[model samples]
Target: MNFPRSIRWKLQLWYGGLLLLLLAGFGFTAYQLESARQLRHIDEELQQRLPMLVDSQRPIPGDRDRRQFRLSTRDALLFDQTGNESFYYVVWLKHGEPVTRSTTAPEDVPQPKAGDPPNRLRGDVRESFLFPGPGDCVLVGRSIAPDLAGLRQFAWWLCAVGVTVFAAGLAGGGWLIIKALRPIQTISAAAQSIATGDLSQRIQTQDTESELGQLATVLNTTFARLEASFSRQSRFTADAAHELRTPLAVILLQSQNGLAADHLTEEQREAFLATQRAAQRMRRLIESLLTLARLDSGELSDNRAPCELNRVAEETVRLLQPLAAEHGASLTTELAPAHCVGNADELAQVVTNLVGNALVHNRSGVSVHVKVLIEDQHAVLTVRDTGQGIAPADISHLFERFYRVEKARTTAGGHTGLGLAITQAIVTAHGGMIVAESRVGEGTVMTVRLPLALRGADST
Candidate 1:
């Protein structure tokens, strides 16, 4: 049989088994008592009758030689030895005769064989009798078979009472088990509902030291951490956007002034170029900050359409090739044909930032490799760089907005420190994840993961 899942069901099974064991024990006890009682009663009856037959052997003074058979209306008889009858009244002897006879016994009453005397009634009911003296004359006997219908009826009633008590106990145990587990059921429901976006939900705790109470405390702590993180991210986004406005406004005004000048000389042209470059940097910074803000805010794109991820990787490589070449780096790609559900533009940006970060940080001889493949039901995009790898501590903070591994490199290469952050943000918006792997001497590898098919499901 299949087992039960709930605590109450388990309790029922255990209680029922115990009840069965108890019932069996009681039945064994009852059978033993009944057998012993029957044996003792038959033994007492035989002892009482043996002496009465001997005393009544002689003739009564008034009634003459007829023996007084005190058989109590039970069949009684008397016999002499040598298989010869002395007197027969209400009882008779047949082929295998009783040593003694009972007057009330049937004529065909089954008798013990010559050497095989009947024992006390400890087995199935059968007719029998015996005596200890010579010939049939010394043996006298009677039959006594009391009706046991009343005893049988009482026994059935006792069994019924036992069964009723057992059933009640089983039911009571089931109720107790349910009561004990109600708190766990409550906790499970609360957890499920809260995951459906009820941040206000808090577990009910009755005892602080109990296991359930401890679990509730832990959940409350986790919620507090999530709330604090969200608040910090929101503030950072506002401050970052405010900081980018000034540089962007200055660049626009300078560009307008240069365009309005009467005669543009080579020196003026060079100054204008620098101003434009600064303007472009400010614009990129604002875009990166916005992207990070969207990511932290959980404003994800729902546009999940089939796209060749490898094609997107190749295009990003082509676009960033000139930038890598300027930094004396070689950009290479091994684009595998892989399909996924995500925003194509977002995937492109993820590849672009990894390549850009590699080229900008390396002093000389940088090599970038981009590959697209499927791994464990996920679309894997890896971008590896042959350069001075990022430090172990700095790799984790690489995706944080405006975090730089080396400040000197940031200044020399004009890095705003928002490239990796923007890349991570874009990947997240498409319901994917990104991580950087690096050691002290070995080069860094940044990996991006996207679901093979969106299927209207969250990221793995």
Candidate 2:
């Protein structure tokens, strides 16, 4: 069985069900009690009139027949019945025939014995029996059809009243539940905004002492600290990378000059060459750092013109051809016009990092295929490599900064472990997403999806 996903609905069902159960029980109990009370009232009335039937007996003064004389005393008690609520009686002798009976008494009433029970009910009739003499007995009764009808009506009314009360209570309870969860909705929206790279977002707490209010306050404080820490880190990275550029350039320049000197011995020339290579590697590392730091600070391209995604892929392919040849890897492409809005340089950098990562991390003879096309109103680019696939456990961490899988392959070039990180940062800045899919012994596929440019964008 599937339960409701919303807490509000779950709580509503539980409380509403409980309320219905309670109302059902209460209504049933009330109906039973009222029915019993009405029956008791009928019984009491029959009991009281039973004595009247016995007392309304006498013998005629000069009449020879005692039964005929006994009938003469009941002039006030017997009457022509006009309604179902009329009282009547039937007196029987020991031989089982009625000795004396009222005019209003039912003809079908059995002749009750002297030792019969005091009260009984058959259908709508209530009766009480009594022994007036050694051989005479009396039964007094009334039609209780009116009382039964009233009780039926009362039962219907109870059902209606119960349903109305339950409906009103459920409505009130739903309103209360919505009011209680409004704070959680606000918290969710604020957290979503903050997650989408806006660290400045904070939850608004109206009451600091309440439970939810206290939670919001704590979250807001945490966001403030996070924003402060990221700001300090970005500033430091940008400042340090910028500061190192001048000295790194000097080192490169001096090493080149030393290599050009004719007076230097062979060993000295090799030393200078080694210094130049190290300086060049350091310069490259610093450049990568500066690029990452800028992307982290949300400093993207100044010139975000409309460009075809296929054009960027073609250009990146041309630039990386020499590296592909050096690794004995085959580079191929299937390009389609996929127009988007972004800096061509930044987009090219993304493609370059992905292709280079695939080429550098795999052994010789690995085939790399680049694809660009439009899919579902978005520009889709894929880089698939026919090499040993990534481990299942490592795919989740592929986009994290400096994360590299420990695969057995020959590295054809230097990897700073920040390539995929930079690519992810740039794609996110362009409102895009990237995903990696792979399995053991199967090849890996890197897919990037970016929103399509407007129809009027300059694809040319």
Give the winner by lDDT.
2
lDDT per model, in order?
Answer: 0.66, 0.85
Off by more than 4 A, model 2? 1-6, 40-51, 59-172, 205-210, 263-273, 301-303, 408-412
lDDT of 2 by residue, 1-460 (tens): 1456888889889889999999999999999999999889888877777666666667666853454314334544443456878888788765668877777888899766556677888888888887766777788888899998999999999999999999998999899988998899889899998887778888987888999999999999998999999989988988998999999999999999888878899889989988998888778778888898888777876568889999999999999999899989999999998999998999999999999888888877889999999999999999999988888888999888767786644433556678898898898889898999987776789999999999987774
Give one clash count per candidate, in the order shown.
22, 0
Kindly list the per-residue Cα lDDT of model 1 for residues 228-267, writing each as its tens digit.
Answer: 7766876687678878788688877888788678889989
TM-score for all models, in order of appearance: 0.50, 0.81
Model 1 bad stretches (over 4 Å): 1-247, 263-279, 407-410, 454-460
Model 1 Cα shift for residue 460 (angstroms): 22
